[model samples]
Target: MLEVKNLAVNYRGVTAVEDVSFRSLPGQIVGVIGPNGAGKSTMVKAILGLVPSTSGVVKFRDRALKQQLNSVAYVPQRSQIDWDYPITVWNVVLMARTVHTGWFREPSRSSQEIVKDALVRVGMLELRSRQIGELSGGQQQRVFLARALAQQAELLFFDEPFVGVDKKTEAIIFEVFEELKSQGKILLVITHDLGTALTKCDQLLLLNKQIIADGSMKEVMTADNIQRAYGDSIFIFNREVV
Candidate 1:
């Protein structure tokens, strides 16, 4: 299980995330949704210790999450990546193994196999030798997905993973997410999608610099919660909330 209690972040005296708390169980996919600048990403970064937290306790399996970093895999927003970095797809996924294999040592045969399997799962094995910058947006996303899979972490975090992908890539990404859940891996995804895709999560965390609601799709998608979080911006889900 992942537990976050009173997680808060500040930027130059301005509170970005305040009094945020949530629990995610294994085999679950939890979606975090909020309007822009609502600290959706900040909350995740705080939990991961990427950003300093004003106050919080984050634990995984009763141990500090910071001590269990090896068990976590994070895929940041696509826009944060440098498309011109001149790296091959195979090498990109292979980098995940460096944490285990060390920077100067050759990857073990098992690690190589894991990388190959990850690429195959995302249907990017054929393009393994291609430069990441040369691939289409969807293909580039798949390469990152492969990198995450190669790590084989128990906890996964994704920020805006579907922002620039094709339908095929979206379908494949969801398919892999479900598979990971079945394997008892927990997923925390930061997304803005409010349509059918949002329903795939087992739980939802609605945010606006703080947790507005945390529950099932039905509970978190209520009209009242929508009004509070998104204000006058109309959002329709399954024609139920408008």
Candidate 2:
């Protein structure tokens, strides 16, 4: 449902990404995996139109990126958000409606129902009244996920959603992703964990400032492909080499 062609991003004359291209189909979990500074995040930001692309076209469902604004929901890296904000869980999730609902209009009954359902989906309903600063790291992440859920987006972009959380929390988040997939929503998650990406993602995009590989996990996660994307930092010992 999403297409990216010849995407390139430059920052002050330095190319962060060049000639990146990929497509994501509905009901698929596409994982973008690469090491730090590999331009994975830059590609995502360009797709979301958060950063200006030097050259490229991003299309969602036959429409340009700008026309698909509300169709996509972005869950930014938790580290980029200010945790000290005085907003409550309910307030945070409710803010998503500001895009659909005008800034001054009170949320309608349907919007409130959606907010409640989103909190419940993420298991944050009980903490709705609690301040965002009062929650733990995992809980904070869930709140953001709930906000995205409340947005009712057909496509979701998540950046490093499992960065600092514990293993149990990661499992929970994956379960949520599976549920979203079952509901036929397109999911694009930017992850650093190779093992998790191999196991959880339906398709994988191995990137290093460009599209190194893009296909099913079995096709894209080969030893050679991983080595190429990760560079010398990744060890690939083999008896065959000896």
Candidate 3:
């Protein structure tokens, strides 16, 4: 299980996320939702050690996660990635194995095999030779998904994965999430698609600089909770949950 206790972040003396805590077990797809500037990404970054936390503890099965980052795979928001980099889809995905491959050493046969299998899984094997900048938005996302698969991490983190992709990409990602969860992989996806997330996420973490709600879809999507996270001005016509 993954445990986050009193996770807080400060940027130049400004509080981004504070007093945030949650628990998630394997085989669960957890969605992190909140308005812009609500510190959703900050919280994820803190746990990943990409950003420093003022005070917090992140653990996986009682072990400190920062000490074992090899078990984690993270895909940041699309805009954070540079698409113009002169790299092929194959090389991009191969980069995921760098932790094991090392800077001066060559990738083992196992790493190569894993990359090929990951590309096949994401339906991007045929585009292996193409440059990343040449692919469509959905294809680009697929490439990153392949990279994450190649890592073979126990924990997966995705931020705004569905923002600009087509419906096909969304469907493919959800299918992959279900497959990973069935294999006991825990996933945390930071998303804004509240409508689709209602049915897709196994659990939701509602945040507004702190955790407003955290639980199954039904438990977290209450009208009061929605107001607390997104403010009362936002319309929430569809609150139904399956």
Best lDDT among the predictions, by candidate number: 1
Write model 2 residue lDDT over 70-158, tens digit each, in one string: 87899887777888989999999999988889789999999999999989887889999999999998888888989988898889999
TM-score list, all predictions: 0.96, 0.93, 0.96
Best prediction by TM-score:
1
Give each model's whole-structure lDDT: 0.92, 0.87, 0.91
Each candidate: how many clashes?
0, 0, 0
**TM-score, cand. 2:** 0.93
lDDT per residue, candidate 3, 1-242, as tens digits? 99999999999999999999999999999999999999988999999999999999999979999898988999998888899999999999999999788867898999999999999998999999999999998899999999999999999999888888888888889899899999999999999887775577888999999999999988988888888888876774455542
Error at 13, model 2, angstroms: 1.3
Question: What are the per-residue Cα lDDT tens digits for candidate 1 across 1-242?
Answer: 99999999999999999999999999999999989999988898999999999999999999999999989999988888899999999999999998888989999999999999999999999999999999998898899999999999999999988987889999999999999999999999999778756788998999999899999988888888888998977654334543
| Alpha-carbon deviation at 229 in model 1, angstroms | 0.5
- Worst lDDT window (10 residues) for model 1? 233-242
* Cα RMSD, each candidate: 1.3, 2.5, 1.3
- What is the lDDT, from 0 to 100, of the residue 186 in candidate 2? 91
lDDT for predicted candidate 1 compared with the true structure: 0.92
